[model samples]
Target: MLHAYVLYGVAGLMLVVRGIETEQRDSRGGASWNEVITDIGNERWTDYYIRCLHPDVIRPLIRGDLPKRLQDPEFRQRVSASLNLHATPGVYLCQFHQTGHLQPGDSQETADTLEQRRGAGLTLRQWLMVVDDCRLYSDVNNPASRNLAEQIDSAYRTTRATNYASNQRRWQSGTRQQNFAGLEEFLNMMDRRWLNWARAQLGTPNEWILDVPMVRAPAVVGQSKNVTERASHHLALSGSSYVHSLISCIVKFRFAYRFDRSVWQLARVERPDHMNLCEAIFSILASAYTWELGLNQTVSGASHQAGSHALTASALNQIYQQNRDENLRLGNVDKSLMLDEQLVQRIKEIKAFDKIKDQKFAELDEREKRVVEKGRKMDTAFEALMAREMSGLIRLQHRQALEASRAAPA
Candidate 1:
C-alpha cells in the first residue's frame, strides 16, 4: 500500500492542499529523485539559492553557459518548464499546461480567478503572473490599479512586435546609470513632422515631466485623416511607451568594481558572482547557505577529518588583507573603473549594436564584461580552504538535488 496526498488541485477558485489518502500498490513508485530535490523537497539552499543566484548563476545560464548535459533540447525544455513553476508556483502554471496537468482552455479561467486575488492588492510580481499566465488585462481585471500591468504588457507587445525590440534590447542586467546625455538631444532626434503635430495638440513638452509615466489611456476626441497614426504618435510622445529613450541622465552613480575573485559591494542591486566576487557573496553563503551542515563554522575546511589541518577565520582574513590593496577602497579606485568601465563600453557599443549584425551577438558578447580584474593575490592556503568548503557544500547536497527533482510533480 502507498499514499498519494494532493497538495493542491483544481477543485475550487484556489486550490488548497487536500488531505492525504492511501491506496494499495504492488510496487512503490512515484516521481524521480531529481524532481524531488530540485522542486518538491526542502533540500538545503534549494529555495533561496534561485533568488540569490539569479544575477550570478542564472544570468550566465540564460546567456548560454548551462551545463553541457542540460543543453540537450529535451532537457532544456524540462529545465525551462521547471523554471516556470519554481519562479512563481501556484501563480504560474505553464509547466502544468505543457504536461497535460491543465485543460486547454483553463488559462483564461485561471487568470480570472487569479485576477480577483490581484484586486485584493498583491505585489507587482503577482499581478505580472496574471498577465503572463492569464489572458486577462489588468484594466479589465481591476480598473482601480490604473492597469499598470496591462499597459506595460501592451507596451512590451508593441515594442517586441516592432523591429525596435531586437534593435533596442539591453545586453544584460546590472546596468545602473552610467550614461550622461542631454534630454534635448533625444527630442532633437524625433521625427520633426510627428513632433510638430504633437506640439500643436499637447503644446511644448515639459522638460520636467518628460519622463513621467502617463497612467491614463490616450484620448482622441475626433477622427482625423491619420487619426490612428496620430494617436500612436501622441501616446509615444506623452506616455511611457518609450520612456527609456527619454531618460538618459544618471539616476544612481554608486561604485561597483570587481577583481579576479572579489567584488566591492557598493550597491545592493548589483549582484556579483559568488565564486569570483568572493567576499560579497561568501558572507551570505557562510552564514545562511551552510545552515544544513549542522557544522556551522565547525569544519569550514574539513578540520574535523582525522589527519587534516583545521582552518581559521583569522587565517582567511590575513590572506584576504594581503591580496587586497589601496584600490580596494572606493576613494582609492579610478573613476572609470568605479563607473564600471566595461559596462559603459558595452552600452555604447550596443547602442550601435547593428554595426556587426552578421556576427553572433553582434560583437556585444565581448563587451558584456562589467568587472575589472586586477587579479588580487590571496594566500594559496586561504584559496584552498574556500574552494574545499564550497566544493564540500555542493558535493554534500548533490544527492538532494537528484532526490528533489524526482519528487517533483509530473
Candidate 2:
C-alpha cells in the first residue's frame, strides 16, 4: 500500500490519506485484519471534514495508534488544527478537483479563492500510506532506511513545541522557528540521488519539488513513472528502493509535524539560504496558494503597481526564469512533457548529422553519400519537431501568465 499525503493550506499540515488495502501474512501464511495507522487525508473529505471533524470521530483518530513520543494531547491538538479547513489554511490544500470546481470567471466571492473551497462535494488529496514495523531490516543490515527512519523520527522530536498555545504565540510574534537542519541536508541528499528519476516522473526536476526529507519506510508511493514500463514494473517503489538495494530491507515509516517554520517552502526568488526541506517545499506551494487565494493582489508599499502586471498561479516559474535563477525553479506546474533521455538522444543524432552533411555530401562514396542524404532529411524533420516542442512550452508559459493576470483581483 502507498502512503497517502494531503497538505492543507491550513497550518502547513500534511495528512496521511488512507488505510492500506491488505494486512500482513502471518507465519502460517494467513491474512489478518490489521488496522494500520489511517491517514486523515485518505478519509472521504465529507467524512474527514464533516463526520471526522466532529468531536467523536476526530477524538478517536487523534487518540488512536499514535507513536509513543507523539501520544500527547498537544500532538492531538496540532493534528486537529492542521486538519481543520475552515479555521486554518496552512499553505494551500493539495486536492483533486471535483464536479464543482470553480473557474476564474465563475468566482465572484473572495472565499472562492481559498483552496479548501475549490473541490467537489469534498476535496481529496491523491495519495496513500501503509504501516510496516516488521523487524526485517535494521541499521546494521539496512543503513539507508534505518538512517531515514531515524532522521524523520528525530525531526518529529523537534516539533514538541507545536502545541495550540505555543503556535499562536509564535505566529503572532514570528519569534519562534524550530530548526531541523538535518532535514535540509536530507533533502539535498535526495536531490543528488533521485534527480534523474524525479525529473522523469514528476515535473521538470528541481522545478517544483516536493522536497520530502525522509519518507517513512516500508511504504511505497503511487506516482507517475517516467522510466520505461518494464523498468518501473521490475522496480519496487519505496524510500530505500531508490537509494539502495530493496532486498530483505525492513523499512519503517512514521509521521511528524512542526509548530514552527522547520518545513521550508521555496519558489523562484523565494529560495532561502538555509531551511528544512519540508519548509522549502511548503514555500513553493504557499506561493501558489497565495496566488490561488488572490492575496498576491493586495500586497502594498512597493510591488502593488507591478502586481497588476505580475504573473500569477504557477507563474512563479516564469518569475524565477526572468530573474535567471536557473538552478532553482520548481513550482506547481505539472510539466508532463519532459526533455529527457530519449529526446536528448534524438536531438544529438540530428545535430551530428547536420554537422557532417555538407562535408560528407562531397567526399563520400555513393553508399555513404546516400546515408548522409538520409540523415540530412531526418535532421530536417527532427529540428522542426524540436522547435514545435519548445514552442508548445512557451505557449504554456504564456497561458499561465495570462491566467494569472486574469485571476488577479481587479
Off by over 4 Å in 1: 1-140, 158-332, 335-410
lDDT of 1 by residue, 1-410 (tens): 01111221111101111111011111323332222222312211122222233233333333333445245677445334222211211110000000112335567766554432221212222222322322222112344333433334344343322322221222122111211111222223222312333345343433322222211101111111221221223222211212221110000001001001111111121222222222222222322222211211221112322222222334323322422232244232332121233223333443443344446464455544322222223456568889999999998799789899999999
Give lDDT tens digits, candidate 2, residues 1-410.
Answer: 01121122111222221221221212223211121112123222212122112223222323233233134667544433222212221222222222223445555563344332222211101111211122211222455545544443343332331332232110123222222122233233333333334456454433332232211111121121232222112223222222111111211122111101111111122213332223232333333323322223112112322222322323433322432221123232332111122223334443554466655766567778788989999999999999999999999999999999999999
Local accuracy by lDDT, each model? 0.26, 0.29
Per-model TM values vs. the true structure: 0.14, 0.16
